[model samples]
Target: MSALLDQPLLWLVVTLGAYRLGLWLRDRTGAHPLAQPVLVAIVLVATLVVLTDVDYASYADDTALITFVLGPATVALAVPLHRQLARLRGFVLPLLTAVTAGAVVSVTAAVGLVRLLGGDELLARSMAPKATTTPVAIAVSDTLGGLPPLTAAVTITAGILGAVAGPSVLSLLRIHDHRARGLAVGSASHGIGTGRMIVDHPVEGAFSGLAMGLTALATSLVAPLLVALML
Candidate 1:
C-alpha cells in the first residue's frame, strides 16, 4: 500500500479513477446540478490531498498524463466544426464579427473592472484573458505579466457565470438565433458555456465550438499587442 501510494503512476490512476467515479455518480443522479462531476472531483481530490498531505506539485506530476490529453481534446472539437462546415460558411462574417466584439468586450471589461477596484497590475493583466480557454488564457496572462493561477481561477469563474446566466440574458434581450447565441456564449465563456449550449441547442454546439477556436486564435494574436500598447 505504501509503495503504491509512493508511485506517481498509482496516484494518477487513483485521481482519474476518482474523477470517473464522480462522473458516473453524476450521471446516475440524473445530472443534478449539485452533483456536478467537476465539483465532485475537486472535492474528492482536495480531500485526498489533505489526508495524504500531498503538495500540488506532487499531485500534478502524477496527473500530468491526464493533463497532457487536453490539447488532443481541444483539437477534437474540430470534428464537429468540420461536420458543420455548410452552416459555418453561411454566417462567416457575422460569426467573426460577434466573436471579435465579444472577445474585446470580455477582456476589456474584466481588466478595467479589476483595475478600477485597485487590483494589482498583474491581476489586471490576468483578468484580460479570463473569458477564454485555459491554454490561451495562461499564455495571455504570462505574456502580460499576470499570475497564471489567478487567471485560471478567474477564467473558471467567468465560464461558470456565463454558462449559468447566458441563456436567460439572451432571452431577455429577445436574441433567439442559435448561431448568434452560440457565438456569444462561446466567445465569452468557452467550454463551460459550450457544454450548456449543447444541452439546449445542438446546432448552437457546432457554432460554439467554432467560436471557441476562432476566439482563442483571435485573442492569442490580439491580446498581447493590446496589452503592450496599454501598458
Candidate 2:
C-alpha cells in the first residue's frame, strides 16, 4: 500500500476513476445539481486524499496532465465564438461594461462579506478573487499576500455554486437569452460556470468563454486597486 502511494500513476488513475464515478452518479441522478460531476469528483478525491494521507503536491503532480488540458480547452472555445462573431460584435461594449462591473462587484462583495463576518484581512484578500478562474484567483491571492490554497478552494467553491444555481436564478429573473445567461454565469463563476454553459448550448458556451476570459482580465486589474482601498 505504501509503495502504491509512491506511484504517481496510482493517483492519476484514482483521479480519473473518481471523475468517472461522478459521471455515473450524475447519470443515475438524472443530472441533478447536487450530483454535478466535477463537484462529486472533488468530494470523492478530497475524501480519498484525506483518508489516504496523500501529499497534496504529489497528488497535483500526478494529475498534471489533467491540468494541462485546461489550456487547449480554453483556447478551443474561441472556435465557437468565431462562428458567432457577427452577433457578438454588437455586444462588445455591453460585454466590456458587464465584465468591468462584475469584477468590481465580485471583489468588493467577497472581501466585504468576509470582513463583515469577522474574518481576518488575509481571508478577505483570499476571498477577493473567488469569482475568477482558479489559476487567476490563486495568482491574485498570492499577490495580495493571501494563501494561494485558500484562494483556490474559494474560487472552486464559487464556481461550483454558480454552475449549480446560476441558471435557476437567471430563469427566476426571466433571463432567457443564451448570451446574457452565458455572460452572467461566466463572469460570476469563471471556468466551471463556462463549462456548464458549454454543455447546455453552443451559443451560450461561446459567450461564456468570452466572458470568462474578460472577467479574469478585469478581476486581475481591479482586485489590486480594491484591496488597496480596503487596506
Candidate 3:
C-alpha cells in the first residue's frame, strides 16, 4: 500500500481529486471567499499525505509538473489581451504606473519593516517579493539572495489574503469601477486574486489578467533594482 501510494503519478491523481473536492465544497458554500478552492485543496492534500505517511519531499517532487504548466497557463492569458487590445492599450500608461509604484512600495515597506524589527537580511528579502505571483516571486527571491520556497509560501499567503479581502475593501472605499477593482486586486494579489475576479465579471477578469501580467513583468525588472537600491 505504501509503495502504491508512492507511485510517480499518485501525487498528481491525488492533487486533481483534492482540487475537485475543494471546488465542490466551495460551490456548496456559494463560493464564499474564505473557502478558496486552492486553500481547501491544500488542507485536504496535506492532511491526507500526513495520514499516508508520505514525505513532503516526495510529494513535492511528484507534483512539480504542475509548476511547468503554469508557464503555458500564464501564456494563455494573452488570449484575453489580444481580444481586448484596444481597451487595454488605452489604460497601459496608467496601469503601468500603478504596477510600478505598487511594486516599489510593496518591496520597500516589507523590507524596511522587517529590517527595522531586527529580522535578518534573509527574512527581509523573503518577504520582499510577497506581492508577486509564485513563479515571479521565486525568481525575484533567488536574485535577491532569498529562499525560493519561503518566497513561494509568502507569495501564496499574500495572494490568498488579497483574494479574500480585496472585494470588500474596494466596496468599502466605494471603488465600483471594474477596471479599478481588477487592477487593485491583481496588483496586490497576483493570479489568485485574478481567479476570484473572473467569477464576478468578464470585464473585471480581463483587466485583472492584464494587471497580473503587467505586474509580473514590471516586478521582475524592478525587484532586483529595488533590492540593489535599498540594500
What TM-score would each prediction reach against the true structure? 0.85, 0.94, 0.92
The lDDT values for all models are 0.78, 0.89, 0.85
Model 1 weakest 10-residue run by lDDT:
30-39
Report the Cα lDDT for residue 171, model 1. Answer: 88
Question: Sort by lDDT, best first: what order?
Answer: 2, 3, 1
Candidate 1 local lDDT, 76-136, one digit each (tens): 7777667768876667888788888877777677777887888877878888888789778
Clashes of each: 0, 0, 0
Residue 123 alpha-carbon offset, candidate 3, angstroms: 0.7
Q: Which portions of model 1 show Cα errors greater than 4 Å? A: 1-4, 32-35, 168-174, 229-231
Q: How accurate is candidate 1 locally (lDDT)?
A: 0.78
lDDT (C-alpha) at residue 26 in model 3: 76
Worst 10 residues of 3 by lDDT: 80-89
Worst lDDT run of 10 residues, candidate 2, spans 29-38
TM-score of 3: 0.92
Top-scoring candidate (lDDT): 2
lDDT of 2 by residue, 1-231 (tens): 899899878888988898899879877987676777788889988999999998899999999999999889888888988987887768989999999999999999988898989999989988999888898999999999999999998889999999889988998999999999999999988888887788778888889989999999999999999999985
